[model samples]
Target: MSNATQTDRWTDSPRARWLAVAVYAVAMAWVESAVVLYLRTLTQRLDPATTTPLPPLERVTEAELVREAATLIMLGAVGWLAGRDRRTRAGYGLLAFGLWDIFYYVFLKPLTSWPRSLLDWDVLFLLPLPWWGPVAAPVSVALLMVLWGSLVTQLPPQRLQRSPPGLVWVLTALGVVLALYVFMADAIRVAPQGRQALQNLLPTRFNWLLFGCAWLLMATPVLHLLIQLTRRQPAQPTASQPE
Candidate 1:
């Protein structure tokens, strides 16, 4: 079938949906960065590398944790609403998350001149524990999320573009575990002491070697997609677009 015919055959096209998702994610990121800016300004700890957690330590920490969880749900809900199936729903979630993260930093640039470089260390998350890593790590992972998500959503569901195998998922899970471990090792070590110990973490350096391995493993599905794409037959020319 012609490319136009194939695209038109779909009852609900992901291309149009992708645009909506992208706009939503970008706006969400702006709000997230603004919120962080306010919190940091309140704490007088605007530096990304600072060891300071939010003030009124216990209450603020609880609030921040809840906010982070709420953000995830909001992102996932948009994905759930946009997709036709479970797989595509997951794709939209990942895509929205990746866009939100990258743009969070983008929006932060003007609000605060923090993260002078990609290598700047950042306190990435605070759910079960404090997750710390360089800005580059999450950005790289976000790029991977975007790649895999686009493939899952935009690629035609045909033999030419099949779902990744079980092994790909296993490797991806392994990668996620490794990355989380790397991000939370400091906090984990201090857990024996108490919350006070975790609150005092500075995180002097990041384990790039381990994170690199994790990133490669996390890229399993993308690698599989590339292999499938290389074996695909060349695309037929389509009708020209209007001027």
Candidate 2:
């Protein structure tokens, strides 16, 4: 079949859905990277380790925060459109987010050469609060998301397990809290002094031990599903052909 015909044939299949989502995320990541390059260049914060890092409160602006929230909404919308149900929708969202994040840094390296090393610190997000971490941290999470999302997307419904129970969810939430604490700990520490303190704060360290524990905790559901799928697989028959 021709390429176009083949695409049309599998357009609604999980494979096509994932492919289209990946393409869209890559293009969107370029746009995201370009926008950040412009902002950082304007603010002179591209280096990230300058005497003063990150823009001031006025320079960062409420408008920019709104834009971040909108970016998340756009990502979620793509997943919602791509999948037939909740599990697949979440899978596609995670896939898109992971690819977008990884490619953002990939594109940025050639454009700005800012993160000299994976250990370089950067302001990862600004939502209800600012999230800060080294380049390696989010990239690690993104890798996990990509792997988990791929499995969730490609597996048939019967092979998939249901969502975790309430206690598992509580643990997941705790994991999220721990990870966020690692990312935003500095900001939280300076919060008593207000926004200026936070803007001026530079992270001196990262809690790798806590982060590792949290990563494992967040992966609980994925581990459970994997075990379930493995147990369900049929055993191979021994070679015993008749004459």
Candidate 3:
């Protein structure tokens, strides 16, 4: 086979898959941004951190929450349809999420232009409680997700099979817990005040120090894998001697 034909075969399938996933994410992000813009405009929450929903539209929260949940399910379904194996499916899901989130912010710019800079504060989510943080925080994590996802999804079989150490997993969980705490600190503090308080809570400051540590801890496994790949020696293809 010619080099071009060989290069276009199975060897390139992962790249093709990655491109397709990215395309889906970007297209979905445009739609999500438009929907969010309309919702926020209606709620007068274009500035979610400080703007309380208009009194008449207060009930929109429940539907907004459901839409967020549905978006996640759609992203996950993209992974399920795109990959043949569990690991690849998971990787694609992560990739899709990271791309979608990052692009959501990107597309929202022209529609609203609210996040004037990276440090601008925003409400990240509305789950068990509200999540609040600077725009930079989630974007940083999203970039890491993209890196780790690309690595696992496109890597050779030998590298992909070598999972990170247990300690790495421990650090990952700890990091996630810490990050969540930081994001929800404001909401958690106001919980005793009642649901109305939660609805109107607005965080003015971010705990960057703690969040920075969490981000580093979360990065351990990805760094470890990268080191392994760099130090790995190429295989010698001698049948009998295995050299």
What TM value does model 3 have?
Answer: 0.90
Task: Show where candidate 2 strays beyond 4 Å.
Answer: 1-7, 57-60, 165-167, 234-243
Off by over 4 Å in 1: 1-11, 51-56, 159-162, 233-243
lDDT of 3 by residue, 1-243 (tens): 998898778545988888999999999999989998998887677766665522334468777788889989999999888777887887888899999989999999889987788888888888878899999999999888888878888897676545567898899889999999999998999999988888777788899999999999989868977887888677878768654
Clashing pairs in 2: none
Candidates in order have lDDT scores of 0.87, 0.83, 0.85
**Of models 2 and 3, which has the larger TM-score?**
3
Number of clashing residue pairs, candidate 3: 0
Model 2 scores worst on lDDT over the 10 consecutive residues at 51-60
Q: Please provide, for model 1 over 131-179, each residue's C-alpha lDDT reduced to its tens digit, 9 standing for 90 to 100.
A: 9988999999999988888888888876334456899899999999999
Best by TM-score: 3
TM-score-based ranking: 3, 2, 1
- The local lDDT score (0 to 100) that residue 201 gets in candidate 1 is 79
Q: How far is candidate 2 from the true structure (C-alpha RMSD, Å)?
A: 3.9
Per-residue alpha-carbon lDDT of candidate 2 for residues 39-80, written as tens digits (9 for 90 to 100): 888887787666657567574667788888888898889989
